[model samples]
Every structure is written in C-alpha cells, then in structure tokens.
Target: MEFNTKPDVVVIGELNVDIILNQIDAFPEIGKEILAQGMNITLGSSSAIFASNLCTLGSGVAFIGKIGKDSFASVVLESLNSKSVDTSHVIQSETVNTGATIVLNYDQDRAMVTYPGAMEDLRIEDIDFGFLSTARHLHFSSIFLQPGICEHLPELFSKAKSLGLTTSLDPQWDPAEKWEVDLSNLLPALDIFLPNKAEFLLLTGTSSMEEGIAMIKEIAPNLTLVIKDGSNGAYGWNYGKLVHQPAFLNTDVIDCIGAGDSFNAGFIHEFLKGSLLKKCLKTGALTGAVSTTRPGGTGAFDSVEGVSKIAAENFKMTL
Candidate 1:
C-alpha cells in the first residue's frame, strides 16, 4: 500500500454526538424527568474529539470512521469539517444510524449513555492501510465502543507500524466493564499507550500504578507509556524512568465529559511534533483543564485561535 498524501495524524475509531444536559436540578429517576438549566448537542466520541482538537492544535489531521446517512451523521461531518479535519475516509452507512451519547452533566461530574450504531460496524475490512499510510501517526480511541476494531486491534496497529507510522491507542472506559484488550501483544506495536489511572490499572490487572507499570514493562520495556490521572494530573514513562505532570487546576469546572480525550489530543499533538515527553504531559494536563472551562468536549476548542485564547485567558499559557 502506498500513499503520496501527507497528514500529521490519522484518527480511526468511533464517531458520535454528545447530547449534554447540564446544570440539572437532579438525577433522573425511572419514569421521571428532570429539568436542566443548559444543554448543548456537540460532537462526541473520544476519537472525534481528539482528531478535532488535534487539528485545532495545528496538526494536519484526518478521520476514518463510520457514520449513518442521517442528520446526526451530518452533525458529525459538519463538526469535523468545521475544524478543518480531513473527512475523506469517513464512511456513510445506510443500514446503521449514527452513534450518540446522552450526557447527563452534574457540575464537575457526568454520566454518559452511548448508543453505538454505525460505529459498531467499523471493522478491519473497512480500514485501508493505504489510507493509514497517508499519515505520520495513527491514533485510535474508544476501542470498546467499536467492537469491530477491538476484535483485531493488534493486527491494525501492526499494519500501521509496518507502514512506518507511529501509533497510539486510548482504550477508553469499556462500557461492559470488561477491559479485554491483549495489552502484552498490543503494546509492542503501539508506540504510545494512553490510558487513565483506572483504565490502566484494569487493563494491566493490577492494584497500583507501580504494579501495572511493572506488568507492561515485561512486555514493552521501550514503550512510551502515559497514564492520565484525572485531577491528580498525568504520568509518562520512558525506558525505566517515570515523569509525573500535575494537573493544571481548574477552579470552575463545568464538566469532565471529554477531558481525558482532550488531554490525549494535547499529548499526541506534541508527540507527533517530537516534543519531550514531559512537555507533552504538561500540555495534556493544560488542555484537559481547558476542556473543563467549557460545557462540552469541544467548547473550549471552537477554533485554533479559540483554543489559543482559552489557553491564554483561562490557563495563563499560550497554545
């Protein structure tokens, strides 16, 4: 497979919209409704959020995902297109509808219910190695949401690596609570493994970060490991050393809906640029904090300039 095109990053995973209910009076009860003060239907899915914000961070990003031929699909496309992300590889499915997440936001906390429709249909066959070769890096997220991708991730990462592209994977919280990824085999092919403290602990089947770190080290000693600890910050490991980057404090957090995904976008954006690991981690924490400043996953990232503005005003840093 060959591709003459050049893109900094190619994101392959689920795509969906987040229907957020913010400032709710109370949590919903069965056969009952709760009135919310604010609401926003924005682009959802960790993969899409990462791709969109990564693009906003000045990366030439492209997305490869499946969506339905419906209005929600239009929202997905329009949202990505608005961010100037390449959507040439996004498939429009006829049978399945576009996936969606109903987000119930309660101040800093959130509960999400996802209906993965077309996203579930994205399989290894749908992935084109030639298309992947067009980019310098491959970042796939929400492995659990895309059962098709989850089933054959090792091969997918291997194929991307064979094409001379660096790769990263963020196995977002598994909805079924079955973190079933074969990390031992998968980590070797994955240049970067971005998982939060909880997800990492579960995936590695350990009680502590040190224990989980030891387990993965046995298989992938050279792997660039990053563990995102919400509020506590992020940690990055390379070789035998570990570096911790504290969370950029956000005093007025609206919600933590896609903070981890935003952190991933920040980390991977710097990573593709060949920045230092510590710098990437710091940027990730800052970006994650920026995500909390707004209502939805992408509110703080309306545009490249918008992200810069948020970074300057809110975080007292430049993007």
Candidate 2:
C-alpha cells in the first residue's frame, strides 16, 4: 500500500523487547519458582505496535522513540522496518540497555515486569520539532512511565498544536499504587485523551466512570475523551453526546498485551477515514478484541480488507 507522501501520524513513545513465557499456572513466589510451558520473544511496546498497526492499515507513519545500541533494539528496528513504519527518527542510545518486559501468562490473565532502561532516558531534547511539524496528527503513549516526556509534554503538545497538528495521548498504567498528575493542566494541551477505565479513575480520583468523564471534561473542555472498558467495550463523548461501543467477542484468547495499542491504531484508522465517533470507537474495540486472539501485538492482519471484513462480520458496520 502506498501511503500519502506526507505522513498522516507520528507516534512518540517507548519500544521494548518482550519476553513472553506461556502456560504458567501462577506467578512465582518469592522463594519458590515454577517453569513455563512455552516461551517467545517479540518486539513490543505501545509506540511500536501502534506504528505497526497504522502502517499495516496503510497509513503513513513515523515513529520517534529511544532504544539502546544493543541487539534488542536491532530486533525492534528490524521489525518496524519490515512493517513499513519509518524509523529515521528513532534515536539510539548507549548509556542504557534497550527496555525489556518479562510476561507470565496464567489462565487468561498475565503479569508483566518491565525495566524502563532506555525508555527512561528518552528526553525532550532528543526530539526534532521539524519532523513532528510534518505530521497531520501526533499520537503519544506511555507518558507517565517516562518522566522526561511527562515533564515536557506541555511544550511538545504546544509545538504540535502550534503547527495545527492534532495530538492524542495514551497514559499507561503507573504501577506505583498511586496516581499523581494535574490533569487539569495536561488535558487542555491534548486534542484526544485515551485512557482505560482504571487509569481514568486513578487520574481523576473518581469512583464512577461518569464522574471521571465529567472531571476530564472540566479540564479539557475542547478535548475528546475515550474511556476503554476491557470486555464491556468503550465509551466516548463528542459534541456533548455519549457513545458506547461494545467489544468484538473473540472465541479464543491469546495475549492481551497489545490490545490497547491495536485499539489506538484502529481508532485512528477509522477516524482518519472520516468515520463517526461511535464507529471509530467500535473499530478500536474490534481491533482490540482481534488483537487478544493473537499472540503478539504487532502480529499480521488483513490490513484494510481484513479489518473491513471484521467490521462487517463482528462490528456490523460498513467500511
């Protein structure tokens, strides 16, 4: 698929090597250990999969992120290149090792332990404003995990907005058992804010989704907020109307690792095609559901034709 000469979206975040161990009955105890049934290594990370899916769906994508000069980074770059995501803006660092995650799958649930490594070293100074100015949209992820990016988000989004580029952000779960941030200040800079129900609640300090949405609206009056509810589906508010889209049911569950990233890709894909907000939410849910049936986040799909088929069969929407 030939994309437009100018890039449609640029994804800025972290890339990591994911080492997945399959079929474990339970997480290892402090002093006890258990062996996994199978293991696999793959290129993983929110930005990586987001870019991959966008490229697969025939979007012009450029990824700006940090990785170490190790073989892990090599594998990630190779994978991205194979998927046609432009990697010219990916910076190579020597101080930190490329990030990696150890995933243990038990039953249908999984546990992950991640070392930020080079991901933490991604600084705003490494960004090239000129490259970002060329994109129609900017998708940012894992901000809270990368302190540097989180601190400099205002400047980054300000530059993008100044250039008339719409900005979207996905804040990953911060496992620190506490949520800290001034959403009131951050949300105004973002055109789209995508967060899972749990993250939304944590960020807003609200007990109900309704309250969370209200709080977000208060902060970012002009922004669109998307709240992803795992199996139940997704909810979005645009033009003061609430839209709910159910998740596409999948028969088999593989790994839920990159589901949200895939959802982001799907949402952006349909939104770019001028789909309605509700339809875009459904597309995101559909892609996320389909992603759970696959083992890896950046796994192959039918791209436009395949997603269209899924939409017709599962989502009951015409592409």
Clashing pairs in 2: none
How far off is residue 164 in model 1, in Å? 0.8
What lDDT does model 1 reach?
0.88
lDDT (10s digit) by residue, model 1, range 222-270: 7999999989999999988999999878988987868998999999888
Worst-scoring 10-residue span by lDDT in model 1? 1-10
| Separate clash counts for every candidate | 0, 0
Clashing pairs in 1: none
* Most accurate candidate by lDDT: 1
TM-score of each: 0.91, 0.90
What tens-digit string does per-residue lDDT give for candidate 2 at 111-146? 889998988888899988887888899999987668
Which runs in model 1 stand beyond 4 Å of their true positions?
1-5, 21-39, 104-112
